[model samples]
Target: MPAPQLVWFRNDLRVADHRALAAAAAAGPVHAVFLKAEAQWAAHGVGANRLAFLERNLRALAAALGVLGIPFTVLEAPRFRDAPGTLLPWAQAQGATALHFNDEYPLNERRRDDAVARAFAQAGVAVHRYTDSVIAAPGTLKTGQGGPYTVFTPFKRRWLATLDLSSAAPLAPPDPQGPVRPLGPALEEAMTLAGAAASAVPAKLWPGGEGEAHRRLTEFLAEAALRYDSQRDFPAVTGTSTLSPYLSLGVLSPRQVLSALLAAFPDALEGSGGPSIWLSELIWREFYRHVVAAFDHVSKGEAFRPAFADLPWRQDPEGLAAWKAGRTGLPLVDAGMRELAATGWMHNRVRMAVAMFLTKNLLIDWHLGEAHFMDQLVDGDFAANNGGWQWSAATGTDAAPYFRVFNPVTQSQRFDPEGHYLRRWVPELAGLDARSIHEPWRYAGGPKAYPKPLVDLKASRERAIAHFKAHAAG
Candidate 1:
């Protein structure tokens, strides 16, 4: 029998510098397969919007694999209940000797990988797991005492100091055209949506596939990197690198993003401009991944810092509806929420603001808000969403202090000063001038149909502060 290697496709789906695929294809003939864990994705509340986008991305990947003369197979594995046992028999029939794949970090995924490793070992198959998720894997960075970092600032500082230019360099896209043995069945054009799929995606919402990802990287490098700092804060402006969706789906690797960023602005990585700040945000992603790895409890919904477990939170349903539907009555909050509802995405600056409104201003549970974000955000990742929500609520490690509540009105006047974003989502406010738009209630007429502020900002901030302070004192 010819030596065969099985490449299991996970989040790291692209071929650019894919260490696992490169290694496996080097050894012998390659068989690439993707496990469609429908039950697991559904159970985790993976919204139709995200699933639909995923399907489009997978189609693009399948096409790319075929051009390289590799057989691509997508097998249905509902949930991870019998993954290892189920997969082993299938692999055995194919007469595979070695299993090659990248690592997964989420709680359930980690468990699934462990079981698969054991099963493969029992079958006398070597399972080789490589790192393609982040720039540096978790536990690679640590304090002098060898303890996991509870603070982001110090961790980021050390991370910047340890940056290696070699790994951050650009990688060429995969060349699949090579002499190889026939492996598995080729893809069929008729293979389409799995189930009751949602309506077609908006033309301008986002572009899918590795090709688009590379195109976006080139365009952003040429245009947006220069003004990434001054313009990213404005929701109405197209200043930010809107690469989160591609990154979250693993259509594009962080390695590729960093390489492009560094090439565009070599000085910006260390300077005081947009590229530097943008790089900082990327570092934030790395920091949260490390936090999740170090504090396993975070994966299971326990506070990263346990003292925050008792933070008082109102799990109100009606309030949640208002928040999710963009009818929260605060223009900025409503605009941010509406953007999420209509497009399945939101601006980053507004993301933090709205998250704080729900967790701090409304005194609602952060997890509830986090869940809603996951349901809405096209780029949502469990670790990043949880880290952000818990941070906004002042419950996670190095969380935002309870005292620093963002004044909604002040935030609007500062960020969306012209009310352009507000006008786009909440069109009723479009007729109002910028001044009246941010605080509609301040006007005597106050746009005819829009609702007034649902909860008083000052009073809510006071209550949230008192609650956190009293809990701390007790």
Candidate 2:
């Protein structure tokens, strides 16, 4: 009899379109393992909300793995270095001849994976890695000059040209091994959260499992895809797919998402309407991941454009606290922040507004806002969060121009229109008319309980631009 194959779970929690799991099962009877690296998460500044979300998803994943005759094992390892010690001995005990896992691109994750590969190789066990998370692996696409493309347009052009639909289609779940025992409660117990983080899970807003992910994708394609481009910016309208949480957790793969998309609109890339715009968003996610890998400094919290490293960011704890608490006095920014706090999610357009308010208007360091988003967001992937903050702050490759600072009031007035979104999140200003809603500060005593503007918008905007100009000129 052949030795059993081991499939190690990380962010890719789903059983379908899972290259590692599929490959492992094809080789022989598959067993699965998940390491509860809560200590590692803490060290990485991962917030409690996301941790709770992960726990919920892991429970779902465990059930799915059990049905496939894979005995799921959970262990605790504080950090990446501890993984080999935990995994190697287990693989040997399980009589596993090979170890398999999907690739993760972060610096620490890469280091940990490289270490695991070496240790397994030393133990005379074959190790296999599959790129399941991204559609195209990083560094595969390059410019005519034979170098990585830093700008998004050329990268996207190459990406679309290089895309092979047949290869990117979702894979079928592997055939089950018969008469396997159901998973025990041990794995579930290992994943339970404790302390304040335990209460932060947005259980209703985000249900775990691949089933929920598919339901969301299906619903979006069926009902919302046509209007996605026009209504996505409006926070009140449910124009966007709520699949980011699933995508970020790898409950849904980009290929699975693209399959659904193409099914609805075959010519989505060339056609106008919702499909085209939404496809662009998916590519943006891919671009950021690629950028993180190609430009290693971003993972280290350094600005993509080194010149912005000397940016004179303000130091204000009170302002930071206000922004976090949704009391920033900019209606749209506050609303976005509050929505994130309540639901572990925020509308994409509002995300830009709040990010800009923090990094440009308040002149706070973009890293602070980036870290805060990662802590609070259920869909927080480091690459996306880091890319967005840096872009908003004009400190990243292919960033919004430094002079293009967002005017929060205009953004709210344009997107919210009648202030429906603001009313939903900022109930204190609910009584105010639409005219006063966007700029509540203009209202008498600012509509009762709302805080006054943290900084003069025009003055701060000018200050940010001047600072950037001075640095550039010098």
Candidate 3:
């Protein structure tokens, strides 16, 4: 019998379309391992919600791999730096000749992977890395000047032009090698530890697994996708596909998503309306990943644009507390924040509104809001969260203009005109009329339970603009 090829599972968990797993199976008999780096994840602002989701997905992954006759092991490594120590010894003990894993672009992850590669090399084990997390591998798409794309529009154009749908089809899971490998005690202990910490987040809201992910994709394409362009912005409607948690954790691969999308609408790339709009969103996600890889400063918590790095951001613990609690007294923004707190996910349009409220109106630092989201969101992905907060704060590539602060009241009126969304999330103001619901402060004898507006939107918008202008001038 040949020495087994070990597959080190990282963010990409699913069996189908898993390049590293496929490669390992093709090489020889395969075994899989996942490092439970709890401390490292916590340090990165990953909260209980995402951890719990990860645990659920890990179990599902184990089951899927078991069907393929691949023995899956869960090992403890409190931090990424401990990975080489934890994994190298295990591989050597198993007499594994080769290790395979998908690449992660973040600075810390890249460093950890490099260290593991070196350790394995010293131990006489070969390492193979695959780019499976993203649709386009980071740094692959460059500008005409041979620089990494900083802007999204041009990058999307290049991505579409270069992409060959036929060539990018998702790979099938490898044929079963032998009898299914029974799980060990480590799996149960890992689940217990993860479950104990994840009590705050309900498991029913998000059923983890590749099956659920594909089901969602199919459902969204069959029912809501046609109307996604019209209804996506409205929070009350189930117009958008709630696939972020799966996508973030690699329970679903981008290739599988694209394949399903193209199957439904062959002309999705060039078509107008919902398909194209959603495709652009997927491109935006890719663009952010590319940005994180190309610009090391972004992953290091620095602004993408240097000019906004030192923008005299205000420090108000009370204001920040209110924003986190969804008591900012701005209907739309509060609703968004409350939704995030309650469900561990917020609608995309509302994410923008709340983010702008924090960075622009409250004048709090974008990093604080970014951290809050990371700590609260089940689908919290570093690249997407960082990119979004930076974009909202006008500190990133293709960011909203400094002067363009979203008026939360106007936004509520436009997006949730019927107040269905606001009512659902902010029940205190549910009794108020649609007009007053948007601006609760304006309604006399309205809900006393609801707090007054945190800041005068007009004055604060002006203040934010003035601050940006002053910084630019100086």
Candidate 4:
């Protein structure tokens, strides 16, 4: 006769390491809910590809929850329209005593959860929130000064010192026998979870489910993980684990990832060199999470480093369209853009390349490119996308200095040397030799009708550096 528990699932979509699920179930019989906030999805700029991934993963999660005798309910709404208000009533009718959910760090999620917690508290219902996303919050890792560290290198160094290899192990599977209530099969009378007609996901891009995530990690740890530090630079190579989407959606927990990493390479478990490098990237993801929280101004689209606010941005529709459609006339940049369009993903090396092209070369605001990427990337994480764009534009905390401009041709030659990546994305250049493919302007009638370079590289580079210098000197 004890009150039931309600676990409102958000990004933490898996069952293996779910603290919220565990706590709630221990307290009482557990019921689960998945909200499909379509309006909020649009406002957050969640792309079609990512939404598809979420839908598939939610279904996978429902199956897992079903095995535990937990009834799964999927609610679709315009936005947060009634989430905070609706949850109290829903939990009451379900005979729930408390609401449990994993922590979500984005601006909107925090607002939603805070409001819901207050509402539930007002109704005399308890709420429990768990942190399963990052290993630790950003403020937890700090310098001797007792303040948040803005620089990544120092933060990464401190992160290593604060580590205990065994404690951060992945969550063990829980006992399924804790509490069971047979909901029986969904009756014909039960309301169906309505959604937009599901679409086919591109196979070449992301393969869904936590199972695929486990497979990817195991495969990477076996062989590809060693080369992750070296060959991750080449877009043509499958050097990097495509784990970002799962991590973003909480299909795979970061603890699970680090556990695999440490077990595979126990010698450097404290972190240094290659293991440290990858770990730093993971921390970067965490850093941006707090950056979005600490600086409400940033969530509002203000630069982390305010001096760059005066940056002169171009208002060129043709140029922006060219860049978006991969007709920027810069082969490497164009190729990177095209890859993003095709796969809803792009390699990290060239992500910086295309980002710099938009912000530095074309003088467009980095947010413009950031928004576009969010609209397309299947693994589009707000923190990573914003951090990357702002970093490349030299407008973020621990961001690169503006004077450091990336030359498209030189970067391509160094990273994608054989033009293999460029050729793969931009097929018109497929027939060309490596040298010509990178900077086609050098060859006569380049790429058989591909547009010529949009602007002179030398002039643009000079302009970018001069602009940043003038801003700094002034």
Model 1 stretches with alpha carbons more than 4 Å out: 168-170, 177-196, 199-204
CA error at residue 21 for candidate 2, angstroms: 0.6
User: Could you give candidate 2's per-residue lDDT for residues 191-285 as a string of tens digits?
Assistant: 67552255455588888999999999999999999999889999999999989889999999999999989988998978878898899999999
| Count of backbone collisions within predicted model 3 | 0
lDDT of prediction 3: 0.89
lDDT (CA) per prediction:
0.81, 0.89, 0.89, 0.79
Cα TM-score of candidate 1: 0.95
Residue 196 Cα positional deviation in candidate 2, in Å, after optimal superposition: 7.7
Better of 1 and 2 by TM-score: 2
In model 1, the clashing pairs are: 68-176, 229-274
lDDT of 4: 0.79
Model 4, span 236-304: residue lDDT tens:
898888889899998899888888887788754554556656767787887788677666777777788
Compare the candidates by lDDT and give the number of the best one. Answer: 3
lDDT of 3 by residue, 1-474 (tens): 899999999899899999999999999999899998888987998887888888888889988888888888888999999999999999999999999999998899999999999999998899999988887888889898999998889999999999977657899999998888666776666654452375476788988899999999999999988888898998989989999998999999989999888888887899887977888888998999999888888889999899988888898999999999999889898899989988899999999999999999999999999999998898999999999999999999899988999898998899999899999999998788777899887869468899998999999999999999999778
Separate clash counts for every candidate: 2, 0, 0, 0
The regions of model 4 sitting more than 4 angstroms off are 177-204, 271-273
Candidate 1 worst ten-residue window by lDDT: 182-191
lDDT of 1 at 255: 82
- Better model by lDDT: candidate 3 vs candidate 4: 3
